[model samples]
Target: MSKPLVSVVVISYNHEAFIKQTLDSLLSQKTDFEYEVVVGEDKSTDDTLAICKSYGDKINLIFSEENVGMIPNFIRTLKAAKGKYIAVCEGDDYWIDPLKLQKQVDFLEANPNYTICWTDYSIVNDKGELTKTDFGYTKDIIDIDFNNLFTPYSTYTLTSMFRMEAFDLELYQTLKHYKDNSLYVLLLREGKGAFLNFVSSVYRVHEGGVYSLTSNYHKNYSSYLNIKEIMEAVPESRSKNMKRILNSLGNATAFGLLKQKQKGEVLTEDQLKFMTDYFKNGNLKTKLKYFKRRFLK
Candidate 1:
């Protein structure tokens, strides 16, 4: 077959119940340009590999004999991509709009300044029941640069499509913690991002979901680590924005610890120090809040 214009990477591990739907959603995409679906089945303990194999020659299947974990599988699968544009659809999530890829590719083709494009998405429960719609944003459209990319307003990985050239695979392989947020930062550093108003995918929240199923503490701590990694990965020229992103993440981490303290959990000295460190360079309001939380009964 001729080379595809776009490559879709679907990473699966023990997603036996959901792999079929994920592959189906991807395969069902109606695009004028050619696109390839690359499935990386990370030696799932369940029937995910079998389900992926059932697709046969329809997708470029990469199945491992042993589990390689999420990040490694992601990197290797990405390395296998042979297209100018790259898109991702996790095993649990599925795209709703058949024209999702076409719309995103068209936008990227027209907008040379933007390196990445993502649409709004819906949230669905395990049973595939729609829990919420018009998720991510209410804006008609928005531009995402490095500064705002660290904010709450951001791209959903499964709904995103980005230029292959924008991705730094070497740098990505070096990251200690690999998450979608970090990947977005790496890509945005090359160019800006765009948020299309339409909902094109469904983000599944299930018991097995890595992020959704974690405790608040783990989630908050993970967020802290994610930002820290991004800060370190950014070059010195972008240090100004990195500082801002650090302050934002630090404040959020402190508040997360405070919530845990209020829940009858004692804050460790290390936790308190980490929280206070974030405020040392912060303003008076932030320092006072930290003091009140730290010293006040």
Candidate 2:
């Protein structure tokens, strides 16, 4: 009769080979508080749906009749979720630490100013083999804002846990077709974001991944569009933050254009100015890197 303290939303689509491990790892979490696992199987062409069903009553499963794509599936899973805090781990990825949920929940409960918390994570191959490389924050706990958070791939999705009440549902619906970063931006806009120093999850990189399937240019462009949407979503009252948002967008667009230039695409004068300004206004280390690339041997 009581609601769970946290809702773990797992979105699956043709992740038959990985769903079992993902679910197992998720349900393995040892928590003092009650947490529900909401699995949204988006009509996977493979045996993903069957595997999810095998969990039976252990998880709240929503099996789609047809493939509704990732964004729709994410939204559907979010809708089914009922918890004070929402944690996400795609079917292709799995949680590494059992305390991930409890730790994040505890932190959010203690810190009213922090809206979201994420941990470090490892990268795994399609075969579930761990790669030597890991993704984590350099600092033990980094407080991030909209301007610093808009860059692409700054954090892993599986490691994220956010407060349910911090977001605007109508604004979130506008991002039904956008990537995870769009939601990340909205969460950051609500309050500060924190990163735990410890590794708590594993992100699987394979041909089936949403961004992995596309070219670098496509991913960059998609990130660009997502940033623009966030800019539009920003309230007019927050003019200062809006300016920083524009700066972040400009920096991303400039870098994306540079990538295009490498492939023989010509850059316009306006685009060049954007890049120059990014380096000029960047921090000391960033300015040094730019100078080294521009003038040094």
Candidate 3:
């Protein structure tokens, strides 16, 4: 009931069945740090809002009369964040490690140069069963150059914690709909990003996720579209880093599209020419990624 040092933000909609477990995991953390769980219930038709309120004083529950999608919901709840650091736990997922907060906070506080730190995750299925998808980012290494920053295929969300300031006005605009990638890329370009060696939580990849229903949800995948926008949003001094970051995002999207389907078929010959020129001028890893993407997605 005392003031919390860390704000554990939980965003939920129609997650009545799984939300309690997620909240319970946050409440049951075995750390010395004082933390409070804040639940932003975005107009659920199900009993999700009621379940969040049932925790009473244990959680700060916000019930919205109007439903905003993930991006707006995040912007809304973040306004209520009262912690030096903000950690996210979606309604469907749970933190497996009780010491997750303590470790992340200690690391971030000790290393002020780093803007964010994210641990690996264990992917779980709808029935709370662990899946074989191996979806979490498993790089047991720390951040190197901007190359590692641009890997468009990271499962880093749901296990990451940030210094809140990463969502500056410039970052907020750059994020657009690709909030996660926007945050990751900005921090990588301007500050440091540490990949924790520990696995911290379960990322429940349910088939009927609320995020699945929205067409705009996958806008992050089109990180290609976010390039020039991010470049312009950032400071001129950081423009070089933005260029590399943008290239990485564009190449990653091309690779993603190829792996997923022939979305390239929608491109005009001119568009294809532009893409091929990008591939030709890119680094070896980027070229190889483009080739694999053209063949696969």
Q: Which candidate number has the best lDDT?
A: 1
For every candidate in turn, the CA RMSD to the true structure comes to 2.7, 5.6, 5.5
TM-score of each: 0.89, 0.79, 0.74
Worst 10 residues of 2 by lDDT: 235-244
Error of 1 at 150 (Å): 4.6
**Candidate 2 wrongly placed segments (more than 4 Å):** 127-129, 132-138, 150-153, 236-297
Model 2 residue 281 lDDT?
Answer: 78
Record all residue pairs in model 3 with backbone atoms less than 3 Å apart, i.e. clashing: 258-297, 259-297
lDDT of 2 by residue, 1-297 (tens): 269999999998889888998999999999999999999888878888888888899999997567887777888889999999999999998988999998898899999999998887878876668864434447778776754563324467899999989967678786633777677777877788987778898888899887666866456546656656766776532346545555555556655665566678877786667667767777676577556655674
- Pitting candidate 1 against candidate 3, the one with the higher TM-score is 1
lDDT of all predictions: 0.83, 0.78, 0.71
Question: Model 1: per-residue lDDT, tens digit, 1-297?
Answer: 589999999898889988888899999999999999999899988889888888889999987688898988988898888889999999999988999999999999999889998888888887767865534566777887765664554478999999999888888888886778788888888888998888899899999997768877666667778778876777632556656766666677877877677789988898878766767866888889877977795
* Displacement of the residue 122 alpha carbon in candidate 3, Å: 0.7
